[model samples]
Target chain A: MKSIRGLLFTALLTGLIAAVALTGMSVYLRVLHELDVVFDYQLKEVAYAATMAHPDQLLLPLPSDSASYEREARLAVQIWKGDQLVYASNPKRPIPKQRQGLTTLYLDDRQPVMGWRVYTLYSKDKMIQVSQPLEARREVGIGMAWRSVRPLIVAAGFLVVLVLVSVSYGLRGLKRVASDISSRSATSLDPIEEAGLPREVVPLVHRINDLLNHLGHAFDAQHRFIADAAHELRTPLAVIQLQAQFLERNTDEKERAEAHRQLKGGVRRASHMVGQLLALARLEPEMGGSADEHLSLDDEAGEVVFDLKPLAEANGVNLALDTDTAWMIGDPEALRALIYNLVDNAIRYTPAGGTVAVTVRPSGVNALLQVTDTGPGIPPAERERVFERFYRLPGTSAGGSGLGLAIVKSALDKLNGTIALSAGEHGNGLKVTVSLPRAGEEPTEAPESG
Target chain B: MRLLLVEDDRMFGEALQQNLRLDGFTVDWVQTAEDAEVALSTAEYAVMLLDLGLPAKSGFDLLSEIRAQNNPQPIIVITARDARRDRIRGLDYGADDYQVKPFDSDELAARIRAVARRSVGRFSSLLAHGPVTMRHDTHEVTCHGKPVTLTAKEFAILAALMEKPGAILSQASLEDRLYGWGDEVASNAVEVHIHNLRKKLGKEFIRTVRGIGYKIGDNL
Candidate 1:
């Protein structure tokens, strides 16, 4: 969109350039016109004076004597009364033709006698013709015209520069809008600010902001649906869990044992699904339920340890961690989920004797958490898709809700961070790295935690 | 020993109550946070098996209320919400332990007993299997009442093994419980502990299944 300053600048420049061209042409024509009258009158006067002097030659050039030059200045012309052309004391170049009124003719091979006005005076014996070149006349006219055109040119240049400066300032609003939008995660659909827009541009900004608001609302509704569904589903699952515990209380030996197993399986499945559902719901940015999650990954990592290594060992996989002190801004629960999911995924997919290693380091302005697993590596085509919701790679026996990586992606995105999946060390398995910015940076890195 | 089972689901609650009674826990069962509140208000329970998802109020809320009232009941929060937050939240709200759902009935009973014993200030109870016996409180071993001497590490290893006779315990778990989290576990730490244990207690007393974890002698 062209700004108002740009439009006005273009209009002014075009008008000024055209005005200059027109004024120059008109003044040049006017100069020729005025020169025609003045030179013709002088020619006639000079011819009459020379004729009155009764020159013997019919076509004589102006005399070069000092007295004649003085008389020529008084007459305001050059007198050509001799038959052969002669040099003039005035040293002004002569015209070639004896034509009446304004006429252009070649005086020399290179120069043309333009706008030369002519007249003739005839006596009984001799005819005299007087003429002057038009070059001198037009120079004065052009000089006068330039004085009028200079201000327009200066004004036009200034207008253009002012427009450029103002236009660039106006364009910064759009750039700010772009930065604001891009800084948000995939699920963040907040409206761009409409304040500080140009009067004319405000409508467009309003429309865009309105569209963002609608999108945000839609995302909110979707997330609310999931959250409500998960909440409602918990009651029945809890009922069944309690009922299972109740059944084990009443049944006899063999029946009681079988019931206990069935009950346990049901409760475990329900609990697993509930955990997955919560993680998935939290992944959506519009819900914004995780906004209050302000815990340092560095401090949390140092203090919190759940003894789940037994699960890995029981599954015939080796679990190890490379610890480092690196602080980051994130939800502590989300960080735990990220680590747990990676480690759990590794243990699930890895064959017996395989090793999984987790490393934490401080990335530039953020903390870097990496999990490397010696399992069947994810195919290149499926690597990016793995972070998507409910996207499970084909041909794996691992039973999971497929929300693990999705949650990690969402959490990292919220922290204004990034995650990358790559080939593990030595090209043997999968390595996933997540980087989250530190807290208390610019603009309060975390969402408002209330 | 008496066990108090607090659950909201009618069927599961009744079944668990019956099973605990049969397993010799003079069991008292209640449904809903209110009923559990009333039961705790009236009667003394040895150990409270609390389910987190209750009808009137949540198990976490009840646990907090119990703590707020200064009622020092040893609570084991059993719930279907196995998320890390739920476990941590329950612990923060004054639960002694957090167990995820679909747990083995026998394991639950064992945990209940262990927690009950811990509440009364006993570290471990004497475990007996046929003719073999290990005393955790006294740190001694006996075969048919004849005392057997074992090294410190060997005794520690035997105590862990005898504590859970049938269940297989992984090397990492054993190491974590024996030594703290920051302790460096040697490559042959478990092997050394097991070898020393076998020298004093008969080698057949502890069984090592190939490619899996270890279990105490089942046929002792």
Candidate 2:
């Protein structure tokens, strides 16, 4: 929930304040130094002026009127020749000096403690000294420092205001984009308008638009599939309804029986189509499955063959299976369905007396599965179309849902398998070959065989 | 009356053909648009019941091709394409009517009869010429206000002739209307059906021109 404008405003304002503070501090320090320079110069001027007159005139009362005022502002002038004090501006606080240059006196020869900026000079056997109290320079420096730092403080305040206003102004485009996205409906996958957007944010918006385009395409494809599935279901349902109506209205017993038979067949076809459609819907999304179960391809294929043996026998078709140790990790249901559909389609399409053979072989890297049937094979031109959902070969009499191969394809995709179709046995039947990547870690020996 | 059904799905076409037959219309079925074109060129179907999703040369192509040749047979498109735009395109391609799939068989039969009737400048399913009155929907006929039983072929023949009274249909055209392909047409099947129709509707109801055809006359 952190706002970019707020953060920028805070950082910039803090930086400006720090810079203004440093500038103000340096300005105040420089003013104090300059004030000390002026005070030191004045002290020397007074000491030299006393020497300008003759040594005898140094005893006359120098114009150090600062002593007439408060004690804090007083400038005391001292003249002495070899310890015989000649003159003193303030007799109560007489300045003492040992050096001929400037110095401060905390305790003069007999006076109490008081600090001073002292200037002492010896001219013609007479020492001239000028001392100013430290308090005087401090008051002047304070007055000058205020004048120097006030504008900087005002500018810092103005800079803070400027940063806040500009930060908010610069972020208005982002705010507008957020509101635009929030106000849209879930189904509105239209691309966001990039006009007038800031440069740094353009890449992010472009990526979002790309994602939206993909989502829109996915939604469209899903919708089209559903519509096609529903449409395909309608014809079967219509047949069932019409047959039921005919069965009800029929008066002749023979016709009634025929209608009843058709009704049953229609219901069976409709139910079979529904089951296949459900299998496809369930398998399409979780491709390869989120949770894969380690299972043997041979075992699943054997299970499928075992289940379909009765159907094969009834149709007078011989069904057989041979397998080797082939292991894979995938959704067991998808695998089972895949094997079941391929075999079931072969059995249904093959005429009576035809045979279907399923073989599984593991070649270390890929698990190979082959299903060959003595059925009327697909023409080379139509081999690719058999995998499309609801596409049926012309004049195909088998009562298939038309989704069997489509389901098989989806299941194969889940297992990361490839399927190839070609003529089987003297070019008279269909052979579907599937190869799935084998799983790792082989057991010491093959456990079961059937 | 006879119809040509252009549907690819065998079971659907078979069931629909049977349903239409029970409704007293002879229906000839073809699985592809090419076959439909062959059938259309050879026979004179009263109306065309077309399915759009054929194996090749879709019904839309057949429809436009036939209409482009100025063939005026009424066509009713029965299809799974229920979109509004599809319907508009179908009608724009010169189809007389459009019927969506999974439709009631009875409604489809009625629509077929209605379209066929409109094509012949008739507005009702019942045809009245002289003493015979035939109801297309009920497959019932009455002569001089008395109910008379007629076979499906008999009803089809009388309806065909009664479409435009006094309009002569040649013997070959009469046979075409009376039977679909694969129907065992007796050597004199149309003659037999016409004789039966005449017996049921009175002797003078249908007239035979010497070298031409048969027609129902307004002057009974």
Give me the TM-scores of chain B across the candidates: 0.57, 0.93
Q: Give the i-RMS of model 1 in Å.
A: 11.9
Query: Could you say which candidate leads in TM-score?
Result: 2
lDDT of 1 at A131: 52
Against the correct fold, how does model 2 do in TM-score? 0.88
Residues A1-450, model 2: lDDT tens digits: 998877887887778777866776777678778877877888888888887776666555665554633344466678887889878877876666669887766655565434678888988888888888776777666656767767877887887788778767767877888998999999999999988988877898899999999989989878988898888887787777667766666677998888778888888988998999899988876243445878899998999999999999999999999999899988888898899999999999889999999999998699999999999999999999999998889878465778999999988888888999999999899999999989975456877898
Least accurate 10 contiguous residues by lDDT in model 1 chain A: A69-78
* Candidate 2 per-residue C-alpha lDDT over B174-197 given as tens digits, one digit per residue, 9 for 90 to 100: 888888889988888888888887
DockQ of 1: 0.06
Model 1 reaches what TM-score against the true structure?
A: 0.47
RMSD of each: 24.2, 4.5
lDDT for model 2, please: 0.83
Each candidate's number of clashing pairs is 21, 0
Tens digits of per-residue lDDT, candidate 1, B1-220, equal: 4456787655456556655544445566776778777777665566898998665477878898899988889999987676688889999999888777655566777887778778866675777776678764445688667888866456656656665678787776565444422347688898888987677667888889776778987776
lDDT of 1 by residue, A256-294 (tens): 676767576556655765787787566667667565455
Flag regions of model 2 displaced more than 4 Å: A27-38, A51-100, A105-115, A121-129, A133-166, A286-289, A394-399, A441-450
TM-score for each predicted model, relative to the true structure: 0.47, 0.88
